[model samples]
Target chain A: MIPNTKTDPVIDVRDLKKVYHIGEIEVPALRGVNIQVQRGEVVAIMGPSGSGKSTLMNMIGCLDSPSDGVYILDGLQVSDLRDDELAEVRNKKIGFVFQKYNLLPRVSALENVELPMHYSDENSHMQQRATDALKAVGLEDRMRHKPNELSGGQQQRVAIARAIVNEPAIILADEPTGNLDSQAGKEIIDLLLGLNRERGTTLIIVTHDPDVSAAAQRVIHLRDGLIVGEGESR
Target chain B: MKLLQVLREAIRSINSNRTRSFLTILGIIIGVAAVIALMAAGQGAQASITGQIQSIGTNLIYVMPGNQLTTATNRRPLTLADSRALANKLRAPHIRNVAPVITDNNDVSYGKESLQTTVYGVEPGFEIVQNLSLSDGAFFTRAEIDSRASVVVLGPALADHIIGKHEGIIGMVVRINDYPFRVIGVTTSKGGSQFNNPDTFAYIPLTSMQARVKQDLSSGRVNYILLQAEDEESVKLAIDEAALVLRENHRLNLRQPDDFSITNQEDFLSIASSITGVLTIFLAGIAGISLLVGGIGIMNIMLVSVTERTSEIGLRKALGARKLDIMLQFLSESAMLSLIGGILGILIGWGLASLIGFVAAQSGTDLIPVVGWDAILLATLFSTAVGLFFGWYPASRAANLQPVEALRYE
Candidate 1:
């Protein structure tokens, strides 16, 4: 595990809450949760069904706004930002990876990696940067291959290339290897851990797999919309 | 996002569903083509009719007896005296010449070929005033009118039909109303359809017509008078001068309306154009309704597209695309579809209009469909506007989707 060398935390949350209203019922997905993680940390959030791990990941990724709380990502207050501002934050700061490898179906791997930059302020050298990102993910030979033409492991690697293309501060991965076979899943895990080690990219992965958690520098446990426990791994 | 990138993305999406996209734009294609084709037809009809009228003569005016605007039955008949008065240069300097004409349909026969056709009783000035030129022989002289002699001129078509040829037909006696009148001349062909053909008439001396055929010499009345102005610029002035002279000859004061109406060539042209303008607008309006229906079809397909691509929208949002980006992407896709359909519609419409012109020409009608630039521009702009307008709702729906729900959607 990398030592906590940074003085300030990259992500700091206090009393985060999210409630969904379906007609007349108020269902609380996240209630009064708090979390803090340092830069260059690889953290895994683990929970069974209805444990609010998905909601927490959504909040951290800036894909949604919390009902009530304080969220400071990289020292910028994000809890009260509007929808468009959240989109900007997501574009420039947070990258996402999904278990299904949410790369656009018909687009080539290089173009998929270029998507975040298309939405970013970086207007120059996009092709070169996307090509470099694909190379980093060991997908240089399959730059022109579409998601369907790739294997599960290759698709996940392409998704990782897309995630890191903009050099975002955090890579928020949800069930990144849930759809892959064991061997492919191990390769994907190694690729991600290798990124964490080589580039020091902050990774916050939400998964139920113990093997993925064992590979993280720290594992966070959640139950019933609240954090139950956390411990340093290694 | 760059516009080119958005357009490229739109093209890819549309190309994926080629059949659906084509079907969706079919309505726009038909609507735009109909608008162009029908407008072209209307313009062609207007052009052909005006061409025919102008072919009759330049700077010509017609003086007919009656209050054409009112339902009065006891209208006075125009007299040869009115024609003579309008012909006086001192009284109406703008009037160049006057021809008094009286027409009656009569059975005309040369040899054994007999056909019922209009016989025009006219003075020598009729040849110049009506722009008639002889194909063979010569026109009757003023002495024929003074002596009330039996002399006749046949139009080219009339000569061809009754005597089978214009050559060697001069001096051939043709019976008009069973009265023999020697054919003096045959006028040049002025190509027209059978229904309104000017090249199918027989001309004779006015006095001969009144004395022999109608037996109305005592009435001293002519059907109408044809007046030619010195030039096109003086046509209106000639009409005004003729009206003043006719009022004086008829003894009509300021309190009474003139018994005769003088109509200039510009009046005919304006009336014909206005009628055609209204017809064109009416046709275009109906075609616009179909374009509106086409817009509705685009909206329907876009709505379905948004629904089908729900997960894509979610994925794009997660990748940090703003709502406006998503909206513009869908909007451009629809606009592109309509613009393409509009361009194709123009080509097809031109083809259809040309076909109409070809068919009309084959049947001896001088019609050439005119596809104006204004029609094409209007169709292009209107179709694109329709796409954007109708696309607004569905695009907004796609933009407003929440990433969480969309990503979860199956």
Candidate 2:
């Protein structure tokens, strides 16, 4: 267990191991991974399929738990956290986007973006924050369109807008542009970079694309559940 | 604004699956409508019967034997002697009026339209004792009955068939039991009675009917005894006195129990009301079971909806929807479905009830179904309750779903 200290990283990882037990067989998803990220950093974790990158992203995003690990995220030990507390942590401190552009299809883009604010304790003004988030993603003009009515790129932008509407300390995207074309994907990466540079929002993208890795300042490459490369990009 | 948005979302969700939503509500509609229609029918029947019983008069009592007591058959047929014995024993304080009745089924020749009727033989006081109306001509007097008069009074239906809707001829002849009897008067129509047709009957004086139409009264038997009291308040006393006199004359121990069932208006009304009430509720209860099935229909559809919108649920949860928000949204949707269905059901049920009332009036029953506001309110409240009951589980399941897993659902 990592002792509670003043110098805890925003995400502190040490010997994180994730095991999946299906019936009698145990599949090791993440084997003894250790990493740390300070505040306000754009870090891309890159690896091919089945390299445990998605599993690591799940642990980092507080979406699941590791079988054997001590994951201290934003100074709170998150690995053994209960469901509600995990949800609270996810609600208050982490924002998520996915490649499929998972905005609710029935609601307008604005409602989808403002929904996360309903979970937060911040009662100042949800509307202004929602508008600001949309403005930040540069899709404020099409706020009234439902996901089905919006193009793939616009939908992805709306999802990113929803992820940041709560003003979480970190933004996590797993294949955020995986469903979009090159132009749409580049626009999404540029939007993430712009948010990182302007608001100093810590950005973590999980992808296997070279373009996605190149857009980040640091690329952590993994192979077969082990980190094969970690260095500043050229 | 928040409420409007929630409602809009709910409406859109329902609109997205119009076929399924409408199909689910069909069950609720039928259940509620059936409940209303069945209850209305029971009420209408009970009301019509009660009206008939009241219209005849409360003071009259029919003492028919052989049905209530099989053992009392050999004792004696209810006889004119018994009626006279009671009349003689009955004083001013005991009873006001008493009349012995002699009735038999006979064919009446009304022009060419000869119909079978149960003819009644009544005394002079029997007209007032039973509240039989006199429309055209007066009833038979004591002299006419005592002199073994051949005069008879035709009921409205018999009169219509005989006189060809012409003005009544007070002194006319109609044959009864192959004997010609003078028509002294015509009684007003008492309408159709469910038990027997009062309209097809012809009335004659008791003594005249005894000698000619029934010629066998020497065996000492009559059909019924009609009684009347001095006032409405003294009817109970008259009843008790009549019971005592009959029991004493029949030589029965009062402790043995009454062989003849004495029914008054109060007893009749109470029995009828209770039967109608219980029958209506039983019918309503069966309809309520169908409503529950309808509620289950809502639940099953909502569950399917949750599964269909797995990605949407995940997206909403990820967007910071608390468990309660999602729950309220779905609950509102389900409640809307049922409440709307309930309204339609009430309208249909009320229309059906009114249609029944119209048909009854056409048949001269004059009974209306009790489609009171209370019934409508109750149906609406119950349907909404069904909505809530069925909607709770699916709403909770949707609320409690994990956002990540939902989003990950393909």
Candidate 3:
């Protein structure tokens, strides 16, 4: 292995492999993949069913580690990171927006957004920043509504509000519009694009929908845990 | 990191599962209440016995003739000369009261209802040693005692036996040995002193009981001697003086064994106290086992709750809750349940103990029930520790769960 270059990207993955072995059977989720997304790039990974898209999304989200390669997210090599360090990277660097809008059922929209900020190093005036994040997502009018009471689009917006509130460098949205109908999905994608355009925050979306891929500036297609093609957005 | 917030979350869990929480605490309540009420009742019983003994005149001392029911007669019975000698010649502080009594079984016939009664021949000062104040009528004077007159001072039980009412029973006559005897006095209803019944027999003059009932006995034959010292501290002086008088009267040397056993009220009360004390400890120790079972019940429920809320725990962990935060939350919930139950148990124990005391006092029984402060403290502390000990393992298990596996738990 040669010395890594000095001008490193925000997320750099080099020949990463993740294998799932159960007894005698071997399941390879990622087969020697190489990818890099520099700062301020809205990148999307597209793949069909059983194409290891969710597995790649999990690895990039820092929820799981690559089987045998280097993963440097925000200049820290995360392939060999311990549990606490992985948790620290997840907390301080990459923010997540799931498709199901995993806002806590009992807490309100503002509290759901405020939850992540509470765990961060941003100590003073946390409430004001949380409110600002909610207002930015255009859900300030529905601040007190619990996730159960909110519509699909509103819940996704609350999730987005939670993600960007921590001031993280990367926003990872894994099929963030999958649970909603087309109209609600359009609203969520529009919100995500607005965040990318306004804040210059790097965006990564793993989705099967071609229209979702078409929204991104750069789209990479995956098949059998390896990138088959890459093209610019129309 | 914030303890108050952790506690608040535990409290919220309690409120969310109201019926389940109440059921969990129920076991603890019954266990703690039983221990508190039983131990307190035992202590109160001991105190009541001591009080009965003291009321029988604290300055009193008793002399018994034999060690057993058989004829082990190294101890000699008191004689009239010994009583006369002690009562007349003893100094003031050492002897406040002295009486010689001769007792024998006799049949008293009152119409068709003839009952065998133990007739005790005693003088006026006999009331002081036995702690008897009459409810009605007057006791036989010194003259009646000396003249061998046929007069009787009835105990409460005997009065009920021979006559029906306290009203005008003083002048009524009852036959003893086919000789008419006037009822001179009726005794107050006194309970057993040092666990011995005080109201079982009637009192007669020594001269009369000897002449009518114990005729084979000579003029000097007295079965027992009762002495009452001035105070508790003066018992030693009184015992010493009485022993000297008995020695001189029997003409004994130091080589010979002592004639009688002398027992004071304090010795009797102490003996009673230790017996009850051991019994109370044993009862509380056994009842403590129930509290342990209750703790296991809490642990079982908490473990079930952790399993039930597997997804919820995952969500909480994913939402950035630390391990210790989750642990403290569950531990606080369990502690809250048992401690609250313990408080209610203490209250229930107190109420039951008080009712028991009230009922026993009303029924003319010697039993008394009370809640001791130490018992209450021990019960509360024990129940709380049960919560902590049994609650810890499940709480730690819940907190140590992997978020990924818990999220996937079906």
The best candidate by DockQ is 1
Q: Please, what are the lDDT tens digits per residue for candidate 2 over residues B1-410? A: 15666777778888887888889898899888877877887777778778777776776655654446546534546777668766874332556678788888888775565767888888888878777787888898989877989988888777777666524667777788888888888787777754577766788988878888889766557777877766767778778777777776677774565555555666787787888889889988998899899999999998998888888877666555667778888898898889877888887887888888888889866677877676778889999999988999999999888766887888
Error of 1 at B258 (Å): 3.4
All models, RMSD in angstroms? 2.8, 4.5, 5.2
The lDDT, on a scale of 0 to 1, for candidate 2 is 0.80
Best candidate, lDDT-wise?
Answer: 1
Q: What residue pairs clash in candidate 1, if any at all?
A: none
Q: Which model is ahead, 1 or 3, in terms of lDDT?
A: 1
How far off is each candidate at the interface, as Cα RMSD in Å?
A: 0.9, 3.2, 2.7
- Using TM-score as the yardstick, the better of models 1 and 3 is 1
Write down the TM-score for model 1. Answer: 0.92
Least lDDT summed over 10 consecutive residues: which range in candidate 2 chain B?
A: B65-74
Local distance difference test, each candidate: 0.89, 0.80, 0.79
List TM-score (chain A only) for every prediction. 0.97, 0.94, 0.94
Model 1 C-alpha lDDT per residue in residues B45-158, reported as the tens digit of each score:
888888877877769898888977765444567998888888899999999989998999888898899888898999998999888899888898988889998989988888
lDDT of 1 at A228: 93
CAPRI grade of model 2: acceptable
The per-model DockQ list reads 0.71, 0.34, 0.25
